[model samples]
Target: MSVIIKAAPLELMIIGGAALGAYIIANPMKVIKAGFKMSIKAMTAKGPQKQDYVELLQMMFQLFQAFRKEGPQGIEKHIEEPDKSDIFKAYPSFMHNHHAVHFLCDTMKITLSAEMSPYDVDDLLDADIKAIHHEEHMAVHAVQTVADGFPGLGIVAAVLGIVKTMAHLTDGVEKIGALVASALVGTMLGVFGAYGLIGPTATKMGADIDAEGRYLGCIKAAMVALQRGAPPIVCVEYARRSIMPEERPSFEEVDKATKEIKKAA
Candidate 1:
């Protein structure tokens, strides 16, 4: 216990400091900032829950209804400044997701302003989704790289401890044993950090990134359906089908939600 207590700070400083330095060296400033932000988000953010998706579909249904009823101009005000739009403001959960908001609004803007076919819209949304995924995953990759290096960094700490131990060999067996034990702490910490903490955190961040991507994909599906002239409810149904079954709201649930919106309208 004494050996570990004495050795832990230095061991952590060595492993953690080196790992952070390596991360900074490997990524650009944007990615470095994003990695830090994403790491924090991984710990705190819940990603998109089922209710969030329900809100998303409901929001889209309302927007599509406006577009269908009053034409492109009817929906323009809402898409142009969603924060001020009563329709957007009604779904606070959907509004809070900036990525989804921009994804849906930007596609709608292009579709309304231009004459792109559904195929072109699909390609455009695909490219946008891929770009976002790539940018976000860069941070995930950075974190995973740091996680992968932890074990190796721990080994380096152990070797430093061993070197320190060599100098104390002439002191006494007890002292030498303590020094050696202290040295081994580095290896233990590194392996534990890599496998027990950092690695899992990176995996979580990756999963969250994927979840966000899926959310955007849902929007893309709806947008494409809208371009193809599917009804408001049908557009959201297309989005619902794109969701993973585990998180998907049922058809009846979506149908009922849209009905309520119609009633409110």
Candidate 2:
């Protein structure tokens, strides 16, 4: 590794510098920051875990129950200021997610007002979900753009290496061979960086973003079901079914959970 670096130091600088400059030019500060955060999250998190999905369903069930038992007026306090509400506070993980919280509260606000049709509410939620993810998609796209440029940048590094070698034709055969080897390392680095590192990271980021959107989609499913006057159990089932199969709670599990919630209430 050190030998490769020593041989290709100039190649490294040119490729690395050009890539960084392009990334900086291509993305705004917000996108650059989002890219960094998304990469970190993709590395650390496996998207929404099974337990996370279960907890989300549980929270929605409780909220719907509150609305059913006490009427819209009774549930008003919880949605109006979720931070202060005991129901939301109980699920610390869900509370920490600002998008989920706002999505729940905003939709509930509209529902309590009794203004929109259930289908209209569904459409509104779909639009909101798309709008929220659009920025995240841009961040992933920026990283993919960088990955796509890497192989070409590697060629650029190799060409520069050859240019430098050309200026040293008077050197011995041993020196010329070393220069050629260094040039080849630049190409290797570029291709390897693209396929092995940045490309894979971008793909992972895209998956994570999709997983997050699906989590929100579950909330939308439940909220729309509620608007349609489904019972709390059916509302939660709508949400539960929206979850990916692996992460989804079983029907018996959801049934048992709602029962426990009722017992507690």
Candidate 3:
């Protein structure tokens, strides 16, 4: 079966152009930029991969150990300027993530101050995670909004097609039927765009956002455990257990890696 619809382009343009304009109107420049980036990244990535989570946990374990051995002063340099720090440099994947770096460093900065109680630290980290997720959710909401409007936009396209078809009524039944079919293509395109493309993407973006939040949550769990005076290894274990099972490293694997980190130190 040959596949082609001549009027699809024009109909799609009407629906797509209006949807894009509405998206711009509904969101700020920052969100638009983030949405674009998130959509592109989602095509290749499904949130934090297994290796990413492994590196994250390893980095946290190492950082905690440094704090244990050298105290606040020794750990200060790494937390303050992580880009220049040798410790952070060792884990390129974790270091490359600005969010993870900032989250780890900032929390360490507060912990080293020796002011906040364990409860207080937990509360602070919880608040920060919530705030970060809230900002990220805005981009997801923007995409979902466009998806929700797509069906109506399709209907608008179909209606416009019908109007054009009306002007050509004297062109004979065969001609009128072709024009009506072209008009119906608009509805098909709109629904397809909404459900087939934009809707699924929005859902994936939301999942990515949630995954990143859970990554941060793992760090928070470890930090809180550290504040409670748990041993460094135990603290990291706490963090590791917080990870989604699929991403969580095996107990033996983490134990062996932590031992190697200690050996190298």
Candidate 4:
């Protein structure tokens, strides 16, 4: 314990400093910023939850109903300035997700302003999803790369400890042993950091990224259905089906919620 206490700081400095330097070198400025931001988010951000999806589905249904009844002009005010739209403001959780808001609003704008078939809309939304996924995953990849290098960095720390131990061999058996033991702490820290901490963090970030992508995919499914002239309820059902089972609101739940929304309208 004493040896670890004495040696841990230097070992951590070496491993942490090298890892930070490597991360900076490997990633662009944008990705570096994003990686740090995402790492913080991974710890606190609960991706999209069941209630978030419920709000999202409800919002979409309302938007579709408006468009169906009154056409493009009806939705123009809402889509153009979503931050100020009463429909958007009503669903705070859905509106809070800036990426989701832009994705939905931007796609709707294009669909309304241009002559696009369902296939073209699908292609466009696919391209948007891919672009967002690629951007977010780059940060995840950067973090994973650092996690992978931690073990090797630990070995480096251990070797440095070994080198220090060699010089103290003449001091005494107790002193030499202490130095050797302290050096091993570096190895332990490295392995623990890689597997027990940093690696798992990277994995969490990746999972969150996938969850966000699925959220966007849900929007895509409904948007395509809307283009095909599906009714508002059917369009939202298409979206609800696209959600992962764990987070999907039940069909009855959604139906009841939409009925309530209609009553409010």
- The residue ranges of model 3 lying beyond 4 angstroms of the native Cα positions read 1-4
What is model 4's C-alpha RMSD? 1.1
CA displacement after TM-score superposition, residue 74 of candidate 2 (Å): 2.8
Tens digits of per-residue lDDT for model 2 on 1-265? 7659795667768777898889989999999999988888878878778888878888999989888999988789999999999999988879988899999999999877768888999999999999989999999999999989988999999888899899888998988988888998889888988999889999999998788899999999998899899999899999998888988889888888788888999
TM-scores, all candidates, are 0.97, 0.93, 0.95, 0.97
* Whole-model alpha-carbon lDDT for candidate 3: 0.87
Select the stronger candidate by lDDT from 3 and 4.
4
lDDT of each: 0.92, 0.89, 0.87, 0.93
- By TM-score, the better pick of 1 and 3 is 1
In model 1, the number of clashes is 0
Which residue pairs in candidate 2 have backbone atoms (N, alpha carbon, C) closer than 3 angstroms, thus clashing?
none
Candidate 1 Cα outliers beyond 4 Å, as residue runs:
none
How do the candidates rank by lDDT, highest first?
4, 1, 2, 3
Expressed as tens digits, the lDDT of each residue in 1-265 for candidate 3 is 0112588789889999999999999999989988888877767786777777777778888888888889898889999999999889999987777887898899989777768888999999888988888887899899999999999999999999899999999999998988888888888888999999999998999888888888888889999999999998899889988988988889988888888888898
lDDT of 1 at 212: 93
Off by over 4 Å in 2: 8-10
Alpha-carbon deviation at 92 in model 1, angstroms: 1.9
In candidate 3 the C-alpha lDDT for residue 239 amounts to 90
Q: How many clashing pairs in candidate 4?
A: 0
